[model samples]
Target: MEAKAFDTRLFKRILKYTKPYKFRYYGVILFAVSLSVFAALRPYLLKQTVDEYIKPKDEYGLLFYVTIMGVVLILETFSSFFFVYWANLLGQDIIKDIRIKLFKHMLSFRTKYFDNTPVGQLVTRSVSDIEQIARIFSQGLFMIISDMLKMVVVLIFMFYMNWRLTWIVILAMPILVYITRIFQRKMQIAFEEVRNQVANMNTFVQERVTGMKIVQLFNREAIEYEKFKEINQKHNKAWIKTIFYNSIFFPIADIISSLTLGAVVLYGGFHILDGDKFTTFGDLFSYTMFIGMLFNPLRQIADKFNEMQMGMIAANRVFDILDSDKDVQLDGAKTANHFQGNIRFENVRFGYIENEEVLKGINLDVKKGETIAIVGATGAGKSTIINLLNRFYEINSGAIYVDNQNINDFKLESLRTQIAIVLQDVFLFADTIHNNITLNNAEITREEVIEAAKKIGVHKFIKSLPGGYDYDVKERGVMLSSGQRQLIAFLRAYVSNPSILILDEATSSIDTYSEELIQKATKKITKGRTSIIIAHRLATIVNSDKIIVMDKGQIVEEGTHQDLVTKEKGYYKNLYDSQFAVDLN
Candidate 1:
C-alpha cells in the first residue's frame, strides 16, 4: 500500500504510547526549552562583552562580563546533558512498552495469518523496526523540536541586535527550505525500499540457516550463495540511494548558509564604516555567530526530520499488523472448565484457501472416553479434521460441538486448555528439558513434571542425559534426537491432563526403541481420555475402538479392524493387506 503523506491518525496512535510516561516526556520538553534559551544567550553575551566592556577599555568590567559568560556556558552544558539524557530515557521506556504490545498482538493472530507470513519479516518488525521507532522519540521528534526552538531564539536575538542584518540572512533561508523539502520526499521513498530489502534479506538468511542441512545435502550452496548475493546487492543499492540524497541536500544547505554568513558580514561592515552608528562591531560579530547558530540547527533538523520520516514508514508497517482484521475473533464467551471429552463435528466444511476445500462437510462423533483412529493417504484430509477440532481455523460452514454445546460457544483459552496435540514433526524450544515439558506452566510443578515423565515411561531415558531434565534443548531441540524430541512432546501433552488428545502421525518416523517407549506411553495416556490418532502405520490402530477409512476428503468405510478386513475391495482392507500381509510373509 502507498504510504500517506503525513498520517495524522498514525501520529496520534504513536503518541498514545507516550501517555504512560508523560511526566518524563514533559521533563524532556522542559530541558529542551532551557537549552534553547541558553544557546541564544551565549551569542548575546559575546556581543555585550565586546561592545560594552572590551571596547570601552575597562579591565574589571571585562573580567566581570567574561565570568558571566563562563557561568552561561556552564548552564548551557548542563541543559544539553539533561536534554539528551531524558529524551533517550523517554524513548527507551516508550519503545519497551510498544515492543511488548506488538509481540502480544502478533501472538493473538490466527494460525492462517502465520501460515502465509514469513517468520523473518515478523522478526524484523519486532526487533529492527521497533528500534527505529525509538529513534523517533530520541533523535527525531524531540531533536527536531529542540533545533527549531534554538533557531527561533537565535532569530529573536539577531533581529533585536539589528533587523536589517537579520533580513539579509533570512533571504537565503527559502533556498535551504526548498532543498530540504525535495530531499525529504526522495529520502522517504528510499528508506521504505531499504526497510523492505532488510526484511527480504532477513527472510532469506533465516530460511537458509534453518535448512542448512538440506541445502548442504543437496549441494545447493553455490546456488543459494548466488541468490543471497543478488539480495545483498539490492539492499546495498537501497542504502546508497539514501546516502545520495543526503549528499546532494546537505551541501546545498551549506552553500546557502555560507552565502548568508557572507551577506551578514558585508552588510554589517558597510553600516559600521558609514559612521551613522547603524551597526556596532559587537553586533557584526554576534550576528555572524547567530547566523551559524540559526542554520546549523536547521541542517541538523533536516537530518532529524529524515530520521522521523523513516520512523513513520516503520510505524506504518507495524500498524498494518495491529490494525489487521485477519485475527481470529474469539466470539465464544462460555468457559470450558471441567470439560467432558465428547466431541462432534456436524456438516463441517473448511478450506485453507478459498474454493479449494480440504475438509468437505465432514461429520464425526467420539464418545466421552473413546479412542478413534483416522487413516488415509497423505492428502486425504485426516489431519485437517484435527486442525478444525482445535479451532485453529474457522469452518467455512456448519458447527462443531463439545459436550453438547457448540465449540465456538466456549472461551478460546478454556477450550484450548482442554485439548492438546502431539504432532509427527515435534518442536521443542531452546530451554531446559523440564521447561520444555511443562512449558513453564506454574500449575505443573517440578514433582508433577517428573511424575508425568515417569508415567509416560521416558523418565529413565531423560535422567540418562546430562543434567537430566535441566539439559538445554538448544534451538528447536537440535541437541536431542528425533525420538527424544518426540518423547518430550508426549510428556508435554501428558502434563496438561487434556480432556482430548491428538496424535497426528506422532509415531511414524522414529527409531524402534523410541517407538516401543511411545507405544507403551500411548496405552497409559489414552486409557480414559478421548484420543484421536491420525496414523500412516496400519498396525498401530488395529486395536482402536473404531477405525475410519478416508479417501478424497470423504470417509468411505468405518468399522473395527476385523470387520473392514473381510471386505474384498475395501480401501482399509487393501491398505492393511498391502502392508501387514507383507510383514507376515
Candidate 2:
C-alpha cells in the first residue's frame, strides 16, 4: 500500500485502542471543540469591551466587561487543562495496551524466530517505537485538531471584524504552507532513518552488554568500542538530519508568522488612518489578535504534523510485528493432559534456515521411563534433537509422537508442561533462589521446593549461602558460581517433576565436586522417568541403557554403552576413546 503523511489505515488501527477509553476520548474531543470556541470568543469580547466600554470611559460598562472577560479566562484555563490531561491520559493508556499486545504477540513466536531476530531490535519495537506512537495522541493528533479548530474560529472572527485585514494575513499563508508540506515530508523521511539507526544501536549495545565477559576475556574492548563508535556515528548522523530539518523549518515558520502579523497591522492601521471609520481601533486590535491566533496555529500545525508523521512511521513498524502470525508456534485445542512420555520421531527433517537442514530425515523412539544418552561433537546437532523434542521450532517435514499421538495434535502448553530441559548454559533470572526454582508457581509450595532441592542434594549447599533459599541471585545469576547456577537450574527442573527430562550437557559447566553431586542427583531423578542426556564428556553417559552417536544431523549408531564400545570402528567407540585415556574395559 502507498504510505502517506496521514496514513488512513495506520490511523484507523491506532484509533482502535481508544475503544476502551471512550470516556477520555470523548472528553478530549469535547474540550478541543469547546476550547476553540472559548479562545475565539475572547478576542471578540475584547473588541466589544474596548469599543463599547473602555472607549467611552463608562465606569460601570468597563467593570461589567472586565468581570465577564475574567470569567472567560477562568473557563478557558479549565478547558485547556482538561484537554491536555485527557489527551495525555489517552495516549498513555493506548501505549500500555499496545505494549501488552506486542509482548503477548512475541510470546507466541517460536524459538527459531528469536534465533534469527536480534534481541535489541525487539527491545526497540517494544519500548522506543511504542513511545513514538504515544505522541500521536498526546502531542500530535489531538493537539493538531485543537490548533486547527482554533485557526478556523479565528479566521471566522477575522473575516467578520475586517475582511480587508484578513486578506493581508491570508495572502502570506500559501508560502508558509507550501514550505511546511515540504518540511513535513523531509522530517518524515529523516525520522524513519533515525528510527533505523536507533534500532541498530540498540541491537549492538544489547549484544555487547550481554557478552561483556567475552569482550573483556578476549581483549576485544578496543575493537568492540571501535565498531560501536561506527554505529554511534551513524546514529548521531541520522538524528542530526531530523534536527537539521527542525532547525531550518521552525525559524522559517516563525519569520513567516512575524511577517504575516506585521502585514495585518500595517494594512489595518493605514485603512483606519485613511478616514475609514468602519475599520475602527477595536477592529484593528481584534485583527492583530486574530492574525496571532491564526498564524500561531499554522506554525504549530506544521510542527505537530511532523510529530504525527513520526508516530505513523512508528505505528507502521510496530504493526509489522503485530500482524505477524506465520512464525507463531502453532498449538492445538486438544490438551495432552495424560502424556506417557513415549516419544517417537519419524523421518523428521528441519532447518533453522531455508535450504540448510540441521536435522536430516531420521527416526527414533524412546519408551516410557527409558533412559537414552546422545553424544556427539559440537555442531553435530546434539542440542537440535532436544529442541525438536520440545517443539521449540517447527520441523520442515516430520511427525513427532508421544504415546502414539502426534505432537501437533496437543496444546503447546500441555505438551511442554510434561517435559523439562536443563541446558549447558543455564539462565537464571535476578531473583531469590526459591523464586527461581519455583518460577513463582503458586501451586508448588515452599516445602515442595525445599524437598526438591534436597532431592538434588543442593539443599545444604544453598543453606550455606548468605541467605539460604532466600539468597538473591543477581542478573543471570552472576552472583553464583557456574556450578551453583547449574545446580539451581537442576533444582528448578526437578521441582517441576515433568514426565520427561532432557539434560543437555547439564554437568559440563560444573566443578568436579558439583559434577559428582549432579551425577548422583541425575541417577536419582532419572530412575523411573523418560530421560535423554546430551553430553560432550563421554564418561558422563557410560552407564546409559542405550547410547546414540550422531554426526552431521544424522544418527550414526545406537546401542547400549557396552554394545556400542564393543565395535572397534563405531562412532560411539571413537568418541569414547578420544574422551578417555584408559582402556574401554
Candidate 3:
C-alpha cells in the first residue's frame, strides 16, 4: 500500500475512543496549558529581578523577588508532574480500550481471515502497534502542543521586552524549520521501515518458536537462526537510519540557536557602548535565557512530530482491520434455541479459494439422533462438511438447513451454541482444566462439570493429574500429553450438552487405552444426539447408523457397515479390506 499523509479523518476516529474519558483528556490539556504558562513566566520574572532590584544593589528587594521565583519553580514542578502523570494515564487508558476493541473485532472475523493472515502480525497490532498509539497521546500530540504553546508565550514576551532582538531570533527560525521538515520526511520513512521490520521479525520468531520441534527434528536451527539474523540486521539498520537523521537535524538546530544568541549579544553590546538607554543589561540576560527556552522546545517538537507520525502509521494499520468487511455474517434473525438435530445440505458447493471447489455440489441428509460416520482420503471434503455446518466459512452457492429451516436464517451464536466439535488437534488455554472444560460458563456449575467428566469416563484421568480438574494446562496444553488434551476436549464438548456432536478424527493420535476410553465416552455422548464422525479408522465407527464413503468432494457410497461390506467391489469394502484383510487370513 502507498503511504498516506497524516489523515484527519483517521485522527478524528481515534479521538472518538477518548469519549468515555473525555474529562481526563481535557484535564491533560488543561495541565499542558498551565505548564506552558508557568514556564513562560520564569524568564520574564528573571528579567524583572535583574533590571528592577539587582541593578540598585537592593538586597532585601532582591531576596523577595528570588523568593517569588522559587515559588514559581515549585508551581511549575507541580504542573509538570500533573501533565506527565495524567497524559500517560490518558494514553494508557485509550490504548487499553483500543486493544480490547481490536481484539473483539478480530473475534468477529471469518475463519478465512485468520487462514490468510499471520498470527504474529495480529499480535503486533494488538501489542506493539497500539503502544505506538499511546505514545501519540503521551509523547507526541499533547507534548507538541504544550511545547508550541510555551514557545508562543515566550515569543510574545520577547517582543514585548525588545522587538529588535525578538525579530533577530525569529529570522533564524526558518533555517531550523527547513532542516526539521527534511528530518521529518526522512524519519517518517525510516520509522515506517522500522515498524515493518519489527512485524516481520515477530512473525518469524513466533512461527519458529511454535514449530521449534519441527526445526530441531529436521536439524534446521542453524538455517533458521541465519534467517533471524538477517531480519534483525534489517531492523537495526532501519533504526540507525532514524538515528542518522536525528544526528544531523539536532546539531543544525543547536548551531542556528547559538548563532542567533551571538547576534543578540553583539547587537546589545554595541547599543550599550553607544549609551543607548533602551537595551539594558538585564534585557540581554533575559533574552538569552528566553532564546534557550525557545530553541529547546523547537528541537523537542521535531522529535515529537516524528513520534506523532509513527502513531499515525500504527493507527492506519489498526483501522485497516476495523474497516475490513471480512467479518462473519451475523444478520440472521431467527434463534436456534431448541433446534432439532436434523440437518441437510442441498447441492452444497464451497471453496476456500475462487475457482477451486473443496466441496463440489454435495448433498446429504442427517436425521436427529443418528450417528453418521464419514470416511474418505485426505482432501475428500469430509472435514469441509463439518466446517460448513458450523458456518465457519460461507458456502459459495448452496443451502444448508437445520430442522427444515435454512441455517443462514438462524442467529450465528445460537446456531453455534447447539453444536460441539473436537478436532484432530485440540487447543486449550493457559488456564485451569475446569475453566477449559466449562469455558467459565456460570450456567454450567462445578458439580455439573464434574458430573459431565464422570459420564465421559475421563474423570479418573483428570483426577490423576496434579490439582485434578484445577490443573493449569499452560499454553496450548503443553503440560499434558496429546491423549490427555484430547480427553479434556471431550469433557469440554460433553459439558456443553450440545444438540450435535462432531468428532473429526478426534481419536486419531491417542494411545490404545485412551482410545478405548474415548470409544466408550463416544458411545455415551452420541446416545441421543446427532453425531458426525469423520474417521480414517473404519473400525471405530463400524456401528454407525450410516457410513459415507467420499472421494473428490462427492459422496460415492453410504450405508450400514454390514450392508456396505457385503458388496464385492464396494469402496467401503475395499477400505475395510485394506486394513483388516490380514486379520481375516
Candidate 4:
C-alpha cells in the first residue's frame, strides 16, 4: 500500500474541481469575515460596559449594551449556519462528481491495471477515501476560514487595546505553530498507515467472503480468520498511533495557551500598578479576554490540522485515479460507421511489463461471418487474447485492425459499440429483469427485451418467475441460478446485436441443459456475424469454422475440427481424444 501513495500533483489537479463553485466559496468567506467582525466587537462592548455603564450605576445603558451584545451573538450564529450549509452543499456536490468520474475512469483503465491492483483496494478508494476528503472539504474548510479570520481580528483588537500585553500573548503563537506542524507531519504518516491497513483489511474481507465456499470446502476457515485478525490488529494499532499524536497536540497547545494567559495577567497587572499612561483596568480586561479567545480557536485549528492532513492524504489517493491518463483514449474520430467484422492481428507483441511479452508477434485473420474457437491451457494467454481484442490492453508492438483499419484510429466507443462480449462470470445488476436485459435504458422497449430474451432461451425461465421480466434480481443476480444468470447475460449481449461477438468461456459455468439451450440460441444470434468462442470444453467448439490450439502464447495447431482431429500428432487431436475418452466413461 505504501507503493500506492498518491502523487501530490494529482491531488492538486483534484482541487481544480472546486473552481466551478468559487462563488459559493466566496459567500462562505464573506460570512466568516462578518462573524469575525462581530466576534471582535464583543470584547470592546464589554470594556465599554465596565468603564462607562457599570462605573456610573447606569442600569439603562448597561441593559442597552447587553442587548447589543446579544444581537451580535445571534448574528454570529446565523453566519456560522449559512457558512456551514453552503460549504457542505458544495463539498457534497464536488464529492459526487469526483466519485462518478473516478468510477468511470477506473472502468476505462486497461485490464492490466486490475491485473496488478486488488479490487477491494479500488473499492476502498472509491468509498472511504472519498468520504474522508469530503469531510475535509466541508467542515474542515469552514473551521479553517473562521479560525484564521477570527485569529486575525482578535490580534488586531488585542494590539489596539494594549500593545505591550499583546506582544507577550503573540510570542506563544510561533511555538504553537511549530508544534502544530510537527503533529501534522506525524499524524499524516500515522493516518496514511491506517488508510493502507484499512485497505488491506478490506481486501482480506472481500477475498474471504467471495471465496467462502472454496474456503469451507478446503477447511481453511481458521487460517483465513487468523489472517484477517492480523490485518485488523494492524489497523487498530495505526488508529491508536494517530490518536496518540493528536492527543499530544491539543494538551501541549492548551499548556502553551495557559502559559500565555499567565504572562498576560503578570505583564498587564504590572503596567496598571506602575500607572502606565495608555493602560486602563477596563482596557486590560478586554485585552485579556481577546487574547484568551485566541487560544481556543488556535487549539481547535491545531486539532483540525491533523484532520486536514488526513483528508489531503485521502484526496491524493482519489485524485490519482481521476487524474490518470485513461489508457483507452476515445479522442480519435469516429471514422468507422459500420464494421464488416473483419479482424486481423499483425505481428502484435504485448505484455504487462516491458521485457516479458505475453503475446509474441501474434498474427491472425478472421473474415466476416466466420466463427472461430480459441483453446489453450491455463495461463497460456487465452484470456489475454480476448482482453486485447476488446482493447482492454494495448499492444506493445504492431497493430490490431478491425474491418482492415487500425483499431486505434477509431474512437474507443465507436470501436467497442461494434463488439459484444459474454464472459464466463456473469455480472447482473440488482434491478428488475427488464432493466438488466435492456440495461435500464428507457429507449429500449419492453418488446425488444422480450424478443432478445426469447432468442437466448431465457424468456421462458424469466416468465416463470412471479414478476416475470419485472422481477428483481439480488446483487450479482444471486437470486438466480448460475445457468439462469448465464441466460440473462446472453440475452443482454444478444440484444446489443454487436457486429462482432465474443463468447469468452461464456458457456463454461452453465449446466449441460442450459448450455444446449444456449448452443441452439447462439446459432440464430451469431448468424452472418463474426464470433470468437474461447472454451475449455472442447465439445463446445466442435462446430466452429476453425479451432486454434494455443500453447505458450503461440498457435501450435489450427484447422477445422475434423482436420485437426485427423492430424494424429497435433495438440487438438490429443485434446479431443482426452475429452472424448472422458465422455465415453
Candidate 5:
C-alpha cells in the first residue's frame, strides 16, 4: 500500500462504531434540526409582534404581543437544551470508541514500531487528540449546522419584510465569505503547527522523566534543562501564532459587521422619516435586529469552523495509530497440546531488520529433559537464539519445530505458552511482591509461589522484608537489589512450570552467594524439561548435557564440557581456558 499521511479510509472504518449508537445519533440530529427551526421562527414572530400588535397602540394588543414574545423565548430555550445533551453524549461515546480502537491497535503493532517510536507521542495521540476531535464533534459540528439554518431562514424573512433592505444585507455577504476563507487557510496552518509542537513537548517530558536517574547520574542536569527549554520555546511559539490569528479574527469580522449594520440603520431611518411607502419604524427596527443577528451567527460559525479544522488534524493523528498493521497473529486455531520437549532448529536464519541477519544458517537440537548450554561473546546471536525459540521474532529462513509441527503453523499464544524465558535484563512490575511473582493469575496458589521462591532461595531474602511477599517493590523493582530482582524474576518464570525453560545469564547479576543459590535452583528447575542456558561464565555451564559455542551468527562447536575442553584448539576449549586463565591471574 502507498503511504498516506492521513488515511481517509479510516472515516468509513470508524463508522462501524457509530452503528451501535445510531439511534442516539439520530435523536441528536433530530433535536438539532428541531432547535434550528425554533431559532429561525423566533425572529419572524418578533417582527410580527413589533409591526402588527405593538404598533396598533391598543392595551389588549400590547398584552398579546408580550405573551407571544415570552412563549417564543421559552420554546427556544427548551430546544437549545434538548440538542445540547444528546450532542455531547454522542461526541463522548464516539471519542471513547475511537480511543479504545487506537489503544488496541497500538498493542497489535509490531515490536519494531514501538522500538522506533516514543511512548509520549503515542500517549498524546491517545489522549489530547481524541479530546480535540470530541469537542468538534459535540459543540462545533452542531453550532455550525444551527447557525447556517438560522442564516438561511433570516435571509428569507429579510426579503419578505423588504427586498431593498435585504439587498443591502446580501451585498455585504461576499466580503464576509472571502475574509472567512482566508482566515481558515491561515488557521489550518497554525493548528497543525500547534499539534506537532504538543507531540514534541510530550516526547520531551516522557523521555526526561523516565530517564531521570540516568540524567542525574551523568550530571547533565543543566544540559537536560536547556534541551527542555528549547522544546518549551517551540511549543510557546506555536501557541503564540495561533493566538495571534485568533486576535485578528474577531476584530476584523466585527469591523465588517459594524460597518454593514450602520449602513442598514442609516438608510432605513431616512425612509421612515420621509413618510415614503419604502419604510415604517417597526420595519426599520426589525431589519436592523435581523442584520445584527446575521453577522453574530457568522462569527460563531466561523470560530466553530476553526475548531473543526484543529480537530480534524488531531483525528488524523489518532487514525494513524488505528490503521497500523498487526505484526504477529495466531494461526491454525489449535490449542497448545503437551509436547515431549524435543526442540530442533533446522538451518534457521533471522534478523531484527531485513538484510541484517543476526542468526545465519544454524542448526541445533535438544532432547527431552536434557539441558543445552550456549556460550559466546557479546553480540554473538546467543540471545537471538532464545528469542527465536520463544518465537518473539520470526525467522527469515528454515524452520523450528517442537515435536513434528513447524512452530509457525501453531497458534502464537499456544507456542508461547509452552516456553518461559528469564532474560539477562529482568523487568519487574511495580506492585506487591506476591502480585509481581504470581502476575495476578488467580490460578496460582500460594503454595506454588512459595515452592518456586524456596527453590530459587529468594524466599528467605523476601521474608526478611517487612511485609514479605506482600511488600511493595516500587517502580521497576527499584526498591530491591539487582540480584534480588533477578531472583524474583526466576521465581516468576519457574512458577509457570513451562515445558521449555530458557535462562539467559539468569545468575550473572547476583553476587557469589546468590549465584550458588541460583545455580542450585537452576538445576532443579531444568530437570525433566528441555532447557537452554546462555551464559558468559564458563563455570555456570560446566555440567550441561551438551554445550554449543557460538561465534558471529554461527555455532562453531558442540560437545559435553570435558569433551570440548579436551579438544585443544576448539572454540569451547579456548573459551573455557581463557576463563580459568583469568581466574589464575
Candidate 6:
C-alpha cells in the first residue's frame, strides 16, 4: 500500500475500470485541456486590450477586445461545467463496477476466508474505502492534471510577453515546490494513518453493535463506552496531523507567490524607467494575472496530490482482495443437478489452520436415504464432517465423493444446491420472515414458503405474528425467540428439498414442544433423504440408523443405539449414561 512518487502501474489498473464509460472518461479530459487554454487565453486577450487599445485610446479597438474576451469567458464557463459533470459521472461509474467485482470475488471465497477475516473490515473495504477512490476522478488525479495544464499555458503567455519576467516566476516555483513536496510526504503518512483508524473504528463499532446483547448481558456498557471513546480519540488525532500540515503549508505557498509577483512588478517598473522598450504596462498587467494563475494551481496541486495518494492506496487495498483467488471455490466443469445422496469421505484430512488437523484421516460412508447420527463431546469434530461433506472448506488430503464420483468433479454450485443445513444458532437478516426464509430467492414463491413452514409445523406460529409471514424479524432474528428463529431456519432448509439434509445441534436449544414438532418434521424430511445429525443430547439420536461415538477426532464406537448401549463402558453407552444421569433417566 506504500505509494511511490507516482504509481503508474496502480493508476493504470484503476483506469481499466473506466472502459465501460469511456465516452464520459475521455470527455472530461478533453474539457480539462480546453478549459486550461481558455483560462490562459483570457489573460492574453486583456493584455492585447491594454496595449493595442487602451494605451492608444481607441474606443472601437476596446469594444472589439471586450467582445472577444466575453466570448472566451462564455466558453470557459461551459467547459468548466461539463468538466465537473463528466468527471463525477466517470468516477461514480468506475467505483460502481469495482464494488460489484469486489463483492462477487468475496462471494467465491471459501468459508475459511470469512472465518479468518473480520466482517466489519470487509464492509469498510467495500464501502468507505471505495468512496475515497472515487475522489481520484472528481478531485484528485484529473483535477491535478487540469491545474498543471493551466500553469503550463499561463507560463507560455508570460514567456511570450517577457522572458525575464517568466524567469522570476520560474525562480519562485522551486521554493513552493520544495515546500509542497515536504507537505505531500507528511500528508501521505497522515492520510494513511487516517484511513487505518477509520477502518479500525468501523470494525470496532460493527463488532460491538452485533454483539450488543453479550455486552449488555455481561453488564459491560460503561467499559465498552470507554473503549469506543479511546478509538474515537485516536481517529481524531490521526485527522489533526493532516489539518496541522495544511495550515502550515498554504500560508507559506501564498507568501512566496506574492513575493514573486512583487519582484516582477518592481523589476518591470525599473526596466521601463531605464528605457527598455520591451517592458510595457500591458505586459505587467498580463504578467500579474499570469503569476496568480501560475501559483494558484501550484497551491492546489498539493491538496489534489494528497487525494490521489489516498485513492492509490485505497485502490491497492481493494485489489488485494480481488487478487486472492487461491482459496476461491473453483467451479468444475462437471454437473450434479440431482445428487443421489451417496456421500463418502475417503481418508479425508483437514484443518482450518495448517498442520493442526481438526479431522484426521477420516473415512466415512452414508448410503443414499440413510440417517447417520454423530454424537461427540465439544470440539470432537462432529460439525467438521458436515462442513467437509458440503465442500465449504477444502480437504488438505484425500477426496469426498457423491454417488462414487469425486465431489470436486461436480460444479460447486450444483453440489451445494443439493445440500440443506439447519444450525443451532440460526442467522436471519433484517427483513420480513418470508424473505429470510426464502432468502429473497425469486424462484421460491410465497405459497411455497408457507407450505414448507407448514411441513415443519411452524406455519401456525408464524401466522400468529403481526404480519404473519411478512413480519420483520430484525437483525439476526432478535425480534423472535431463539427457538422461533430455529424453526424459521428449519423451514428454510425444508423448502430447498435437498437430497442431503443436516441438523448440526439443530434441536439442542429448542423448547420441548418445538422440539417435538421438529422431531416430527425431521422424520418427515429424512424419510428418503441422506441425513447427517450432530448432537450432544444422546436421547435425540437413539433412533438413528447408525450412531457414531467420537472422541478427540476419532471414532470410538459405531452401531445401532441398543447395540452400543449394551456394551460395558462403551463410548456410546458412556455418553448415554452421562445424559441419563444428568436428567433424562
- Runs of candidate 2 with Cα error greater than 4 angstroms are 1-3, 582-585
- Give candidate 6 misplaced runs (Cα > 4 Å): 1-3, 273-275
Count residue pairs with overlapping backbones in model 3.
Answer: 0
CA lDDT of every candidate: 0.88, 0.88, 0.90, 0.83, 0.81, 0.90
Tens-digit per-residue lDDT, 164-232, candidate 5: 878888899888888887777787787888999999999989988988999999998999999999999
Clashing pairs for model 6 are none
Question: Which run of 10 residues does model 4 get worst, by summed lDDT?
Answer: 1-10
Worst 10 residues of 3 by lDDT: 1-10
Query: Can you tell me which runs of candidate 4 are displaced by over 4 Å?
Result: 1-15, 266-281, 284-288, 326-331
In the range 195-230, model 6's lDDT, one tens digit per residue, is 889989999999999899899999999999999999
Residue-level lDDT for 218 in candidate 1: 100
Candidate with better lDDT, 2 vs 3: 3
Error of 3 at 225 (Å): 0.7
After TM-score superposition, the amount by which residue 296's alpha carbon in candidate 2 deviates from its true location, in angstroms, is 1.0
- For residue 268, what is the lDDT in candidate 6? 94
Q: What is the TM-score of each predicted model, taking all chains together?
A: 0.98, 0.97, 0.97, 0.92, 0.92, 0.97
Clashing residue pairs in candidate 1 are none
Compose the digit string of candidate 3's lDDT tens values, residues 25-122: 88888988889888988888888889899999889999999999999899999989989988889899999998998888888888889999999999
lDDT of model 3, residue 149: 91
Candidate 6, which ten residues in sequence have the lowest lDDT sum?
1-10
